[model samples]
Target: MSGRIPRQFIDDLLVRVDIVDLIDSHVPLKKTGSNFVARCPFHTEKTPSFSVSRGKQMYHCFGCGASGNAISFLMDYSHLGFVEAVEDLAAFVGVDVPREIGGDFSASDKEDFTRLYAVLEDVAAFYVDQLRTGDGRIAVDYLKARGVSGEVARDFGLGYAPQAWDVLLGRFERDALIDAGMLVVREDGKVYDRFRGRLMFPIRDKRKRVIGFGGRVLDDSLPKYLNSPETAIFSKGKELYGLCELLQKKSRPERILIVEGYMDVIALAQYGVANVVATLGTATSKTQIDMLFRYASELVFCFDGDNAGRQAAWKAVDAALSCLRDGRQIKIMLLPQGHDPDSLIRDEGKAGFEQRIEQAQVLSDYFFDFLAGPLNLSSIEGRSQLMTAARPQVEKIPPGYFKDMMWRRLRELAGSRVVELPEKPSTLNRQFQGKVGKAKTQRPSLGRRVLALLIQRPELAQVLAQRHLSLEGLKFAGQELLEDVLRRIALEKPENGAILLEAYRGSSYEKTVNALAGVELDIPEGGEEAEFFGAVIQLLKQSRQEKLTELLAKEGREGLNAEEKQVLRALLRERL
Candidate 1:
């Protein structure tokens, strides 16, 4: 059980696991042209905005900003850590994760995760075994009473925790229970079971490894449900119940419905709503929402009718707005009065509950009409308050045509004759003005121009360096970045930008690499290159003079350091 998984093993595993097949599991990808096309799972869209290039082994979503290789997609979509994602991918191709050369598990940082997985599996088996016993009959009866079928219970990995706390604590050592995050020990040295007298629901990762558990009390208890605390293997914020089974099915859900409790999820699935999942008694996070977007074209939030539910919906809406792009859509379904999903399924039946889903309001409609309703547009003060409240939400939206439409909608809502408020600034117009002003004020520095030229045609590197081209005059924070590039070129004698990037593999200059690699250099025509070279030399000379002047001012003639004196003499000599 050594930690280090060999790099070649991971690469071979990736080769075995077809990228297209892996991506297809999460999204409904149709063959389009040379690549596969699917409605971007990262955003809600009617038309396809996501494309997977099989040849390139990359996927990009045009609607949302999700672009990544196979590993990245798995990590983001499955909410798995880098190592966990690799292991999951490896498992899919039926390759064993390679162990380190030695018995030491420190080689790969995944040893803790691997051990946790083992512990969770053991706990799941214990729970399952307990559920089959006579004591488990109470848990089964409770589930049946709540309309959870045997199939649904099995599908969800439902089990039973005995009423006595020590029943579980006695089975495992204190360290083992603590490692599993199944027991909490008080300051008095008393160890207490995290879940007792409750129905156990195994929390699984995308690869279907039970990483944690959630337990619901069979009867009246202070806290109805208790979830496993965050452990090395479990993050409550990033996990979604039922995602593993849904992904395995490879059926793209039209819309993902997010609910609050585990019972709600079990209840929905029991009633044939297999696409529904519930947060682990926590607020919806951007990470969870992002994971949902990977498998679903649209998202519908089903919250309770109470004030708490309304507040949760608002938080979800705001979170979605921050992460969701133009093509993605989000809808909100507020359950009818005094109805939880568990109660609703029992009361109204599946079809009746679906009708409520059909009536779910789009995010735009919810924002403009429902959520923003408290602000009165009849009064001037009310109009001002509405605009103030709306600005921050609107600002959260990335700059684009969609933001413009939203601004116009806001102005129309707040500035109409009923309210007759001032017209809001157009996002596009402001962006255009800012771009023009920036272009006018900021001229490209000689150092930047030289670096760009070198990056575009590294043959120019020798010519530029031979002329003693210095980047000291550049008015940019990318000074150290340019220096790193120059150092790489000097050390490696790279014939091109690509070679230079390869040579500086572990350098802290990746931002420079990205900029240089992604951007097209504007090489001027005719004598412009010579003119640029001359300007660079002149700037360097001027910068040298300024350095000398500063040194002289700081340290008088009598107090002049050797380096300072030599630098002063060099500047004067250069001038002469």
Candidate 2:
């Protein structure tokens, strides 16, 4: 709502929302000593790999390389946008999110979203009513024939689009419907209903606001299913149908089932198998996978047995690779030929369906089998081709025992361990590696070390500032940020990292602040004050020596004026 969330409010919010309690509410953590432990929600693993530090108000997962503070955890775990996560954390702690509106800021962006939600709600109700009308009777009959019940249909808010092109034009504003993706306007300037003579399923978000729609024709059609185009309110890739209901379930689900369509989701729910969601006219995307993982530890992707289905499953496998870590599991289940979940559920019923789910192939198993399916393992050339094709995809997965085991299995199948399969870090870990860099385990640079110490023990800023350090002369990668942080602490005197973090809360420096706050320093808790000043003094001495060298060069080459000569004298006069 403004330039940024006030630093004081964020600091206060952090105090109110304990990081442990906040993560535990979503992930169910067990206390062990001073920290809490849980399986990393970001990855698939059998043993717990996630740890939360009580002292630092931070959490890091050893298995998956996920690490962040309370707000970061909320964003990752709850799939909230940064601002949304901040607001959610504040709400969790019973505080309101405070905003600072600069002269250029306005509340219209937030207000526009609120209006869009209202428009979607009205469109959803209109669709629901259309299902019961005379023209919608055909759609009602179609659902009845498919074994969908009135109760279940109403629960899902199933609707019907009348055969007429402009049925909604008289009832609702055309522009609103178009913006909501319910109406289509062609280049020739003709406006008509986007979905016609079809059964409609409203797709809602986690907040239960209708964002989009999925529709299936009542009669035989070339393209059987149609979905709402991307709109201001909807992103096809990020959202899943029936996710709202999945989140609202009273009992925790052991795993989540992702299927192909909206009807598949509703039909499964009708059969009392409710831990299901459907991707909206798209292959499973990484964004959707992350959001789904928030509610369950395992993901079972249901695909058809055909080649197309296998292709889709592989896309999911690829998308899920960066997300896979210890404590999270991904499985692939292919329905029998000619059977989708909709038809299979009708034929096999719940008991038989459960058996098939139990038989779902684990990611490693499916991956190997899929790769081997097109190869002749008995031939050396075939085995070599198989290995070449698979190694790239296998390496995409995070470094773990699972990856190692998969490589071992592949080698065994190829009839050779002659060439060793060296383990590589996962793509996810590579990304995190880029953030922390090689410097994470190595000794930090002088500037970084000083900043880390100042962040951890903000009082060090006062000592450095009291010396009236010449920040302009400092040549470092983060000189400006370090100087700004020191200035804030020296002037405003934010007592700790918690309050210091507030200055960075909604700014570009937030990432740097988080990185510094989480980084481990070798200094003992009681010794940071000395370490801070010591690093700064060393930096100052280095800078003064460099200045003296430069001045000597200038006097030798270009010559120095009286003022420059005075500066050179001062540098020469300084002692270490």
Candidate 3:
């Protein structure tokens, strides 16, 4: 609990948890050939683009470019953080995660957050208790008037704060409540409840643990929303209201709606629209947007159709551009004047509200439209102005089809004044243009093939060591990585690809090793050993040829030493 999870533990955990079994339990994989296949859970695809390799203990999505080991799969599929995902996997395999001596977490850091989470949970329970007790009827009646049902209220853990200042102060420890952001200490040496006479919305993380609270006054009051102060466990910019509830309703929603307030989220959910989350009194951050995309592919930011709403939506766009990928989408939906999501949902009903969602302007369209505000695009000067304003933001988009299409749209809008952009990289199309029609005649280099084969079946390392050959002087692009893999395989004797790659995690070779783990080698089944030895022999011979040529050149320049002469003689006698 004090330090990072030991790498050895993680490697062992990967060995215990079979990738095929783990993914099958979640995604219902079908055996297509040697590996299992499923429709990718990360994106919407008709074809089964997701593959789980039993031999490698890895999953890769051909359509969306999602690939990783078991820990990564949980992080994406369950929306859990890294530690949480590791813990989940460990629990599945019935092992406890061990911590190293020096890691990101200290003992106090671990204990403090544990206590903070517990105190927050207690505080939330106390507030929820207040909702059902005396004077709770006002809060309950307020919710009823807003058409919030009992079930939805309970589902979201809606609560109430009594008007008294000492309610929570007297119940929980002073220091713990203050640390939890429940009790505030003023400069005058007075402590009071942070939320009073308000409806409380407990903000929980993806793990469904309360981290903070958002309090809304029942009647019209200054500062209509008073949120929990930034604490160790809570950052308003990184948290979203109703997200845990949304995930509970559907583990993976087709689309997620973003609103401005807690009531909007609650009201929408009351109207049978369950896939909505609200920004907690701050502009949406990239962290929140990334978190949202983990649960849904599409996001609709629903704001009031006022100048302020447009301003907020624009800020969201600025935050979202960098997060755009091939399959992800962001849309902006501005409600009618004088109405927010709460009032609009009640007035228009669920069908009408969802219709607005479907009609929301896509981010690309909204982005250009927002940039073209009051600008005469027909005029050269105005088009030039648009190009200048949009170039930097457009470049923030990740390289993919989405970025390419956005560039195309910008060019069409800025026709004569288009700024020359870099030529699109050829690799951008590789994700979409998969190996559907390509012939299998192409093969990677011998070194690369050996690396791929070793990754797919780490036991091949033992087979390789049996040859009693050493690649001590071989020089190639991935020579160092190849040496490292063989060395790790010898030391740890990893049972599969996951355990073998775990040693390379967080190292410079992680991406290369993982890519090799997922590589589709074209060698015939049961021919891995022959191919492996054949490649090894060729590389050794190639290396010897280079050395022989070097020694002969050195002899012509200066006579060779005894060892060098013997090496040259041995190399000359061997068949090329």
Candidate 4:
């Protein structure tokens, strides 16, 4: 096993994998002629413009201009990392990824993930078995007392961890159990089950695989709820309690209701409101917000009306500031004091609970109300304070209609004491700067042409290499990058364009290489070799001409050195 996945395997996987089939599994594609077309999943569009070319094993969206191969498509659509995408493709094709044995990659890195997930699954089963046994009466009674039916209990994979500490210790290997976050090792080196005598709720990912657990005590415990410690498989800030189940109900629900606890989600589902999720004992995160927005446009947060609930709602607002965009909405719902979503929903039935969600305060109103709650807007001091606090939060939002409207609302609130914000460089200004740099690099230069052509048709590099072209003295902005890319292509001999792109993943020239890869050239099909060689030859000639001009100027300033004179004579002979 290698530390890094072998490059040859990745290229082979891309060659064997079908982009059309892979994408259709996620976003259905319809065959139109030799290619396939679908509504672009990356952006909202009415007509089908996303095209998948079976010949090239690549997909491109005309609407958004998003273009990539299978691996890139999976990375974008599923939000997977590059290696994970490659792993998925490898899994699809039924091949084990062979990695290099030596470097930073270790056996533990691979073994731990597999072992962790397996141990978690086994531990969840143990808890479930405990729930079914005679000793599980306490857990069963607790669920019944909470009005959780047997079917719902089973659906949520509710279980019971035994009161005995060694129950899990006896069943599984100690290290595996500890690594899965099922056991705690004290300083004395004594290990024990982390969730003893607690009713268990297995937290699953989108694949319905149990990644971690949330344990609630059957009796009076200070913490009340205990979640699995952050493990390789589970990050509290990233996972939602019932998201997998909610998504099972609706792939894209109209609106998702976010509650405060696990029971709140299960309770809401019991009451026939199935589109509810809960943050795992942590404050809502921007990552979770982004994930939820992928499934639903609107998110409604239900919190208790107490100070803690208000604090939680405010924290959610802070996290949501940077995530807000046009067409996405967030609402804050505060239940009556002394009640959480579980208690309130139980009291007010499904209809009343849902009514609260419907009448929930919009994010804009809640934001201003919370900001001004402690300040007197009539006084300049209070308004100044508001401006001081609000400006930073408002600026976190990406520029769009939402941001503009927020600014307008701030002005209305500030009234006579509106703060004049310092003008910063606009996004357009940054884009203009980038364009200027791009224009400089892309000025119909032979170097730029050759680089772009190589990225688009990397196999042409082999031909260029075979020509034994001497580009040693070539000097240009992107000349080194061009040579590096050509050298890699000539050595690796990657048959897929995505594989070539993937090779540049973390290189300094990754951005430039990707940008050039997307550049549309005027050369027709089968003319890439001619264009590539033509550009390379012209670039080399231009370098020579520039070198000759410099040497001639040096001769005028001072007599040329022996070496410089020889070079000048050879250049003059070549010119004649």
Candidate 5:
């Protein structure tokens, strides 16, 4: 694989994958006027505050500060790296991601990893074919005995890898299988299939492309289930077992059920409760949580009713703090002792299993419950300890009613203890993002205004440049960033916010671009262009003042040269 992914692949992938189509596949959106609207998945909320623009091909949460384009959304939601997200997007849109390998392109270097994806799919088909062979009866009986109907088995892409050491070697190239994660090679040069003697589950991305596999041994084994190692297309921490099928449901599922095992997810599907997914031999990751939020507003984690399980749930609580936006719900369902989703659903059926879901503890209740478990909240020292532990987590949440509510709950737990709350963090670093739109700071500075205008109407960059304008001598806080933008604008001349944002992907000013791109400025409706020019004029005025200051400082420090004195006199002759 090439080390550096070309920018052209990213741009092409963005064009092929529409932002609305990508986000709506996860978050159920309703057509609202010209755009789509859904409750923001970033924070907890009661109404729709998230909006997707088909025109701009971007999304923004009016409630919390979360905002991005299609590629960024996948990175944040799926917890994928930049290259991984690009590959996944390209696969979704049926394009080949051309990676630029060392200098010029050769035929081998230009080959996209799509071929590896194809190999995995073929391997999945072979495993499914194996399940029907005479030697595969044990695997078939195992599924049938576990109550997996043939239709459900087919629905989940379940299969069985043959017990023979060289079963796959005869039909496929060993190196291709290795790259696709279907085979393992030893240092001694011995190579074998990775899933021999095991029932197979093909792990796919949201696009329904088979990327890797998970296998469970039928006999007594040290490790009961083994998943494919991370390949170009698969990251175990980022995928959920049944989400691809769950997303295809007609009525969007209101809450997603997260469990620990593949059978747990498949078993739930068998019982007609299909909103469940399984993490692949890992903890509930932040990417997993964020991805779950894309499909539903609420998530209920099904764990065993044991101390160990409670500890795991608490870990989930800690991981979820950073991603918890207002309007989203997270809960913990500790199943009765000695019962897992698979066994419990088999014993009590779907209704009984859902009863436990209904009774699961809300995140806030669990948050305090878990923290207060070791500390005595009744004592003053214990209260101080509790506050000390909870303050940092409370501050991490995005500004919303949910965060405000958590703070109040913490204060209530502290009884007469003084806890200082930080000032409200806004979506756009100002109070105007709140429902009241009250201005909490002074007027937007010349630097800030120039950034706002360029972000809102990106084409204005070309107009500003055509007029022979630049940041020049402006020395405000974001002046350096403004100059960078101006240079890229003059060189690349991107047309929209999405393209403009892409221009600064790995630049130091990425966060600033993200913040500026998503913010809806308070400029007057009809006079956007005029307002931008006006801001530019103010910025230039500040640049002139900055120049004047520099000249005066130079003269103060040492006697000015004759040319400097002439320039100073000319500048001072002009009226302020």
Candidate 6:
């Protein structure tokens, strides 16, 4: 694991895990002509803007700017690092991920990840063994009482931590537990267990490695739930509980059910609701929502009818709205008074639960109706109040038809009084100001735009190279992306955008390549080519002239610095 995994291993893994099969598990791709089409999972929209090319083993979401290979998709969707994604794909195909491959692979991060994985595996096993015997029976009984079945419990790798603080501390090396975020050291340098006497719910990465844990207290305790602190392998914002199993099963659950606690997930799963996961006792994050897009196109956020749960659902809805794109959808489901998914499933059975799920409303619809319910729309002052409250929320939406829809709904709900709504200040102005301030502060030299022109037209590459245009000449900060393209062109001799992009596969510039490929290119012909070059030269001359004028005005005759004076004289001499 210390050495870099070989390129051949990655290639073999990709071959084993068919791109079409892997992508289909997350996206409901329907046959559209020769390729498959689904709503882009990356952005919000009603129409499909994402497509998969099986022949090329790639996917591109035209809506929210997500485009990548199968490996990248797994990494993005599952929140697995590159190595983990590769290893998982290899294991899925029943192939071994070799610890060492003969190559000069340069990613220290990958090495760190491998080590962390080994440590986490050891920790998960320890917890599982503890749950099988000893004080872990308390945890087992607790789950059973909550309506979690043995099969579901086994499926999720649920376990328990003993009452003793050092139960896990004694089993593993001190540094290992600390590194894995399983222990907290006090001021006296004595390390105590992070999760004691609680049912252990292993939070796994998409590759099926338990990266962290969510612990549920069996007894009536303050806090009731505790989760693994953030670690190199786990970020609460990025990982979801059941994604690994869902990905492997390749089942497109019609709808995804999001709950608040581990027991909620286990109980729902016990009742054959396989597409359920808990948020580890925190608010839903964008990463979690993005991960869900990989599996279910629609997500139903189920919470209790209590005020706290309703508030939680509101937050979840807001988060979901930000992450939604063309094909994906989200809904809010409030359980009956004083009931959560766990309690409802227990009292009324799976049928009762499914019936309520069927009635879940789309988030936007729910939000509008919920807001309307409390406010009186008939009164002018009430409408004004509603607009005042809703405008801020509307402004938070990224510019799109979704924003328009919200405004339209407001108009319908408030009628002519919609004008009373506050107008959002221009974000573009804010963004421009930010960019201008940054430019003034950094004053980064512009990278050569000439290289971009050359990459777009391979025929121009030789001309630019002949002119001694290297990446250093390109003063632009993002010139690295262009340099990557030029390097690809030099080595691959790509005749077209598609070929050029293919040559960049598995390279760091894959996303850049995809973006470049998406750009429409124009290759001038005959006189037009000459005219284009002439226009470019003229623009350069004009730019130089403008700079000289500015310098002359600012510094005058005696105010000119030596280097500037020399340059000015040279330019004057050239013009003369």
Q: Which candidate number has the best TM-score?
A: 3
Name the top lDDT candidate: 3
Tens-digit lDDT track for model 2 on 1-576? 234777667766776667888888889999886678999887778999788867666777766566677777877766567777788888788875655776343456555666667777887788789877788888888888878899888878888877888988888767777777778888998998888888888888876888888889877884799988987668999889988877777324789999998888878988889899888878889988877777778999999999999999999998998788777899999999999998899899999998889889998888878889889999999899888987787777677877777778878888887547774653422333245534457777776777777776677767755777665566555667676787788676765565676567677676666676756665765677778778988887777788889889989999999998998888777753
- lDDT, each prediction: 0.71, 0.78, 0.83, 0.81, 0.78, 0.68
After TM-score superposition, what is the CA distance of residue 280 in candidate 3 from its true location, in Å?
0.7
Candidate 2 segments exceeding 4 Å error: 1-79, 87-107, 250-252, 416-419, 423-576
Q: Write the per-residue lDDT of candidate 1 for residues 1-576, one digit (tens) a residue.
A: 326666556555644666688889878799976679888865569998777766445566655545555676777676566677777787777766767676566554465666678777888888888888978999988888888888888888889988777777676656767877988888998888888888998988887889899998887886888999988678899898777766665545777889998888888888888888889888999899877886776899999988888889988988877766666778999987799998988888989988888889988778777535887788888888887777788778765556667777888878843332334444422332232222312554555555555554445556566776556544333445556666666766654343443444345544344234323223344444575577556656666767767777877745777887787777678779
Best of the two (3, 6) by TM-score: 3
| Candidate 5 ranges with C-alpha deviation above 4 Å | 1-3, 7-112, 179-181, 184-188, 219-222, 250-252, 380-401, 416-418, 426-457, 461-488, 496-498, 504-576
Tens-place lDDT per residue, model 6, 461-543, is 56555654333212233445555666767876754333444456676655455543322223333442453354345545655
Residue runs of model 4 more than 4 Å from their true location after superposition: 1-12, 24-30, 38-50, 61-67, 76-81, 98-105, 325-327, 416-496, 500-576
For lDDT, candidate 1 versus 3, the one ahead is 3
Model 3 lDDT tens row, 128-160: 899889888899999988788899899999999
lDDT score, residue 229, model 1? 93
Model 5 lDDT tens row, 104-217: 445564343667877788888988998899768899999999989999999988999888888898898787888887778989989888878899988877767897888999
Check candidate 1 and list the clashing pairs: 41-293, 44-328, 415-421
RMSD to native, candidate 5: 7.4
Q: What is the C-alpha RMSD of each candidate to the true structure, in Å?
A: 10.8, 9.1, 5.6, 7.1, 7.4, 11.2
Candidate 6: list runs displaced more than 4 Å.
1-112, 417-499, 502-576
Looking at candidate 3, the ten consecutive residues that score lowest on lDDT are: 428-437
Model 6 scores worst on lDDT over the 10 consecutive residues at 432-441
Better of 3 and 5 by lDDT: 3
Model 1 weakest lDDT span, ten residues long: 432-441
**Whole-model lDDT, candidate 2?**
0.78
